[model samples]
Target: MKKLVSLLLVLLVFTGTASAADLSPDVRSAILVDAASGKILYQENIDTPMPPASMTKMMTEYLVLEAIKDKTITWDDIVTTSDYGFFLGRYGGSRVFLNEKERRTVRELYEAMAIYSANDATAMLAEHIASTETAFVELMNEKGQELGMKDSNFITSTGLPRNILSDYAPPISLGEQVMSARDAAILARELINTFPEALKIASTPKAVFRQGEDDQVEMINWNWMLPGLWYELEGVDGLKTGYTEAAGNCFTGTAKRGNIRLISVVMGAKSKEHRFKATKELLEYGFEAFTVEKIAKKGDTIKGYEKTKVLKGKKLEVPVEVAEDISLMVKRDSKIEKVVSLTTVEAPVKKGQVIGSVAFDSESDYLREKDKQDTEINMVAVEEIEKASLIIRLFRGIKNFFLGLF
Candidate 1:
């Protein structure tokens, strides 16, 4: 009876303190980050670069969304399929089977690319937007650099194997698209933040491409974490999945439970099932271990934010405000300290001008080691402080001069 009790105690201890270390995922790299704060929750080989199959489409999606935002393109805009795009689909790659000279709307192509992972549709959209796939690839690389994705290099819109386009007799090995797990998370966050509507498209479990009376193509979303898939989990919504001979199986997944959102990236997994399994583990660990709380709202006045003296303005001083909402993810049941600091602003201050910052800190060694304990939030001026009239300015200058002499 005592031995049985001891065995049960050991099981309880392991279950209570379970972490990522307890599970072994057959993947080359993986990472999980708090979608709101971009704080890494769990990681393994996050910096190692691996092939990024169709995951490259996220950048393509970003550019398409940007163009729409700037009015350069619209969802209703007709995209004329180029010969290059047609040939890519014509050849044996995954596509919506776009014929040469086929005309499709921007929205249709985006759905194909985002939902079906259609290589032809991706190339078609790229050519329509940039006049050529090569130019679109250049844009993708530029955006990657802008996003600080140091370990990523995008040579194609589709994450297809490099040699697929090669004419070499011996099939000379060309470099494939590569990205670190950390870089993938950064890219995913940017995608969801910039055009959250894209998630609506990605969340679909199955969609019909070019739905019509003729040649209707049935497209299934590759993300198994979404509903109706083998690994369906509540709250799992968006993301992209990729696979290639070189890349193995990869997935960039995100889920929101209440106010907390998480982004998980798994790359180079042994199989399709393994990649989704690994991602689920990371996400479950994050949701189980941490909770995100809204510490402050944007424009909320910080307690004790004293009015700053203004040299020449309509009012003698102005109230300070938070520039943006502040939210932090901390370990469950852990306590933290919020430290607010203010900086005095000079006259001629404009509304929303940053002046100070608030920081969160803790003495917990575990929090410090995980690099999750401390963070800073910026403060801004709530109201504008106009410059005084020339006569008033001159009078103040003379008064200041006399005061300085005294």
Candidate 2:
């Protein structure tokens, strides 16, 4: 059985593969991916680079959350609004109307930036974290590179178009911040996976900042397409929005329905409404077209992999079962096919030791030649296999020798 199974694994690995769905979305640059698997479900010019606008704040928000978690900064730590950050003046894209020398807590600044998309508040927070906006932008780029965001170059912590006199950029070069739709999706994925709490603020349509004070102002989230907003889409939580003359209207959003979560990015739409409309269409297309398909469940035995030989063990063989529940986002129209491979191992096998794996692929004849979209899980030993006693091992060796003589 081991010999036969080994031969089958070679065939499955080499001869079997499937292709992805060819979906044409309505947007200049867009991508929809499964948040868990990072699988590209649909894309249109996803690699095309464009200015990301305020979506760049998501990276700032992520770094701030990291500071909070690591104790480098506390939510209640007061941050002073430097004259440079406070005086961006009305000309700056968006602001919380912070006053120079005014102090506020890290939590308030974070809320202001996340909900209001305030450029002023973003600058203050950047200065607080790194003592200067220039140093903070350096941190932003370093983190982006670490996240494998090759196409992202964040010049501003606020994601605003770089301006010569504004603190967001240096006094010299004036260049727009840029990122690809695919890269934005990757950044959003990292943010959500690492700090899910950030979504609570991103999804909120409105909140009060500096409450019950002379400077108190209501900060309404710019993202109106989220749930509880003007145009409600169930499960549409986060993440950020961006717009500049060069970038046009851009949005990077995420939604979760049941066990499946998806990230969608749309860049360079004609208008704010158009960006949201295009994003909504892409997200709807994803949920309408794909579903979570269960490949295997924990403790379930593989049909052909009932047992594997255990050398020098009290038991000659041991039962094997799926170690984890495996599932994948699959096109509803495609059929699922399984490719199983079980490995035979020597004894002293511990319970839960991985001994093999199974992969699931699309069985649609049309996708036979397409790129493979599959998810796999390991098969594990269900029970421990202790070494056999000396007498038992000797008896087995003698028996095998006699059988080989025949």
Candidate 3:
């Protein structure tokens, strides 16, 4: 019986390992994450940086949106094509065939870049914002660092290879624009969270550029998983795609179903079809295997630490409750452990003031170190607690002193 049991255990271990290996996407690097909680569900070689191709435009898009939000520029602002923008628009890898010194509104250029991935439009926007593409490259790197993209290097706003730009290329020493799958996903998350309206353009399947003009062009989005596209995965929406000799094919995709939204990145696929295929696999696995579970609701009191002692308050103890709802994306069958730390507060405490914190740890392997901070929720005062009268405080102090002596 012992020998038979040992053999069964060995088989189970081997099968489990093989199952995990089989689920890894067939790409150079990939990662899937819950958009709300930033929990990593699936990851493979996510930190290895490689050419990101046109996906670099995401940073340009972010900066443009930032400018608009800051009121430094507006969608209706007109931008004239610079010498570099004109040259790149005429001869760059992907373009809308912009004429030298041609003028277009920020809205038009933005649509061209976001929906069509037009390299020239991207370059024009960069120049318009920073007075030069080289200066814009500095802003991109600065923003990347702020976003905690540890393995990313932005050499071009359009993600075009430096050689393609020839003399127009920024004077940066880096050879090319590169980002790891994790960084790409991080950018995607930040972009959508910070500027959700971006999806309005990114999800657009088709549009006309310079409509009804001699140089008009029809722009079709490269993301195939969007609704009404070839792959047409339900709930799949706004994102970006890229391809280059060095980067192969790459995609950052996002989708939402019910209350759960997921972001996925696939880099270095052999073909366009393969990139989307890998993304679909990652999304399906995430949707099927995990769910966002709400462990505590706003105002729910922590069980054992429901009341915290308050010094010099009308009431010696004040009730405390969670400040925000705590939710986490966890495996379907996994168990969760709740750990809490409570603290005392001085009197004159206001309702909603933080007094403690609660953390929920799950028995799953998908959690990452960065996500640790997100799993905790603040505990706050459930109601106001004003300081007691001086006479009452003195009497209470004397009573406590005598009690301590006993």
Choose the strongest candidate by TM-score. 3
**Which ten contiguous residues of candidate 1 have the minimum total lDDT?**
1-10
Tens-place lDDT digits, model 3, residues 77-128: 9989888877877788778988888999999999999999998889989988
TM-score of each: 0.76, 0.83, 0.86
Indicate the worst ten consecutive residues by lDDT in candidate 2.
7-16
Candidate 1 RMSD to the correct structure: 10.9
Clashing pairs in model 1? none
TM-score of 1: 0.76
Higher-ranked by lDDT: 1 or 3: 3
- How far off is residue 154 in model 3, in Å? 1.2
Best by lDDT: 3
The lDDT for every candidate, in the order shown, is: 0.78, 0.78, 0.83
lDDT of 2 by residue, 91-136 (tens): 5677778887888899988998998888888888888899988889
lDDT of 2 at 245: 79
